[model samples]
Target: MNEKERAPIEDTHFGAVTVRQDGQDRIAVDGEAIPRVTLERDPAAETDPHIAIGTRDPAHLTMRVDGVEVGLLPAKGRFSRHSYRVDVEYDGAAYRFVPDSIPSSRLTRDGRHLGDFSSDGDETVLAEWREDGEIRPADAAIGYTLASAFGTGAQPMWMMIVDGVSNAIP
Candidate 1:
């Protein structure tokens, strides 16, 4: 039988919750051992690729949270090349994940500051958030996924220097 080979699975923890991605298509939360999240890709889709939660089916690009279907959409960045934003609305609040640099992104809702997610070495960390206790597990999960997929981990000082020198030369 011909079966697609799966990539090595990796688990990343964000406080109490654990997110596991198979490095290919599957991503799960809290040791569910089932594919509760996936990256669905379609050349014809406006978003092209979407983060699917609660199922592996490519047709379902949205996840139901509290009876509300939250869909992830990719919006092109206004000023940067090769950078984009992921937008989602959950519980009546519209959230946007904007990549600020190679290793971090800021989270905002309706132009209000909310939180920031960044890569620390090999791990993604929720560096800060609103003090009023507005962030949720779903928010963390989605944010982590976005960071893992789009943002690069923190680079060593040597690597950064090398990159800087290379860019300068070119």
Candidate 2:
């Protein structure tokens, strides 16, 4: 039997979650191994996406983490993009993860628009964050908000459209 090879997708980490495509596909949150994590369309499948140039309508990935699944990140099509939505049960209470409309200017915890993205340094990591439900506009450091909310954040450059294909993470 022969084996196929692909470039190693660098693992991106936020809060406790780490997305990696190394050996034996893996996703770990806060060091807890997420058994049987798979990315696919609504029906689910065992496949790796080869995003060709000019590919539109980027597929949606429903990440099954710890049996409490959520859409990992919204897809940006040729004409639009969608905000991140996540809902998880914490301490028997339902907590929802929501973000402001793009340009992803702000984010919220449980529907409360804590604050907008900070205009700090070039650290294009987390774009939504708050303390005690208070965030100051212009304090734009998007970090640990999404991951802390549903268990994350991404780089701003990650949102850039590369070669006609959006690199907003898979």
Candidate 3:
């Protein structure tokens, strides 16, 4: 498959949280750098080598942003479809992750939202994004929310190369 591409916007980022994929998901935005929750397929730190994220075993991963623990999606999602949800408690508000459900997915809060991501086929470029009801440029929510299922034309939407790392319901 060809890599996803988008027309670069000159300085689209303005006091916004942007995420971009820079060779191995550097997780950066607007020339600034931010840490992200990491997902290791076969983490050496894991005690059991047999435990792996696949069809049966759930993915045991930690989601961190800017070197801070933001959430945990440890083997609770459907591994069969590479779908997982990382529950998070940030700033006294609860947040949930939608691991690529078809063309897009989202990171939501109580009544509002955190991030909304959308894409057509290319998992690399998130076409639309919204955070907290604010319309953020596609890459504004950058840095990256790497998932087990990025997208690959798989049957299940989660299995597709990528659901969406940004936010958008419309």
In lDDT terms, which candidate is top? 1
Kindly report which residue stretches of model 1 are placed more than 4 angstroms away from their true locations once superposed.
1-14, 30-68, 76-83, 120-126, 152-170
Instruction: Count clashes in each candidate, considering only residues at least 3 apart in sequence or on different chains.
Output: 0, 10, 23
Give per-residue CA lDDT, model 3, range 4-121, as digits (tens). 5544323333432333333322223332322233333334334332222222123444444445555444334444334444445544655554544544555566545545454321
What residue pairs are clashing in model 2? Answer: 117-140, 118-139, 118-140, 118-141, 126-142, 126-143, 127-142, 128-142, 146-152, 147-152
Position 45, candidate 2: lDDT: 33
Compose the digit string of candidate 1's lDDT tens values, residues 1-170. Answer: 11333332233323444444443333333323322333333333443233322222336444344334466665543335224566777667787777655666777776676677775312234456667656655566556555544442234445668878999995
Evaluation by TM-score, superior candidate among 2 and 3: 3
- The candidate 1 region of ten consecutive residues with least summed lDDT is 48-57
Candidate 2 achieves a global lDDT of 0.32
Off by over 4 Å in 3: 1-42, 45-59, 79-84, 99-101, 119-123, 131-143, 146-170
lDDT rank order? 1, 3, 2
lDDT of 2 by residue, 1-170 (tens): 01333232122222232222222122222222223333224323343343211111225334443355543443332232233344433323333443334334355445566544421211122343455664422111112223322222233333544623744546
- Against the true structure, what is each candidate's TM-score? 0.53, 0.32, 0.45
Candidate 2: deviation at residue 165, Å? 19
Backbone clash pairs in model 2 (N, Cα, C under 3 Å; residues 3+ apart or in different chains), count: 10
Model 1 residue 10 lDDT score: 39
Write down the RMSD of candidate 2 (Cα, Å): 11.2
RMSD of each: 7.9, 11.2, 10.4
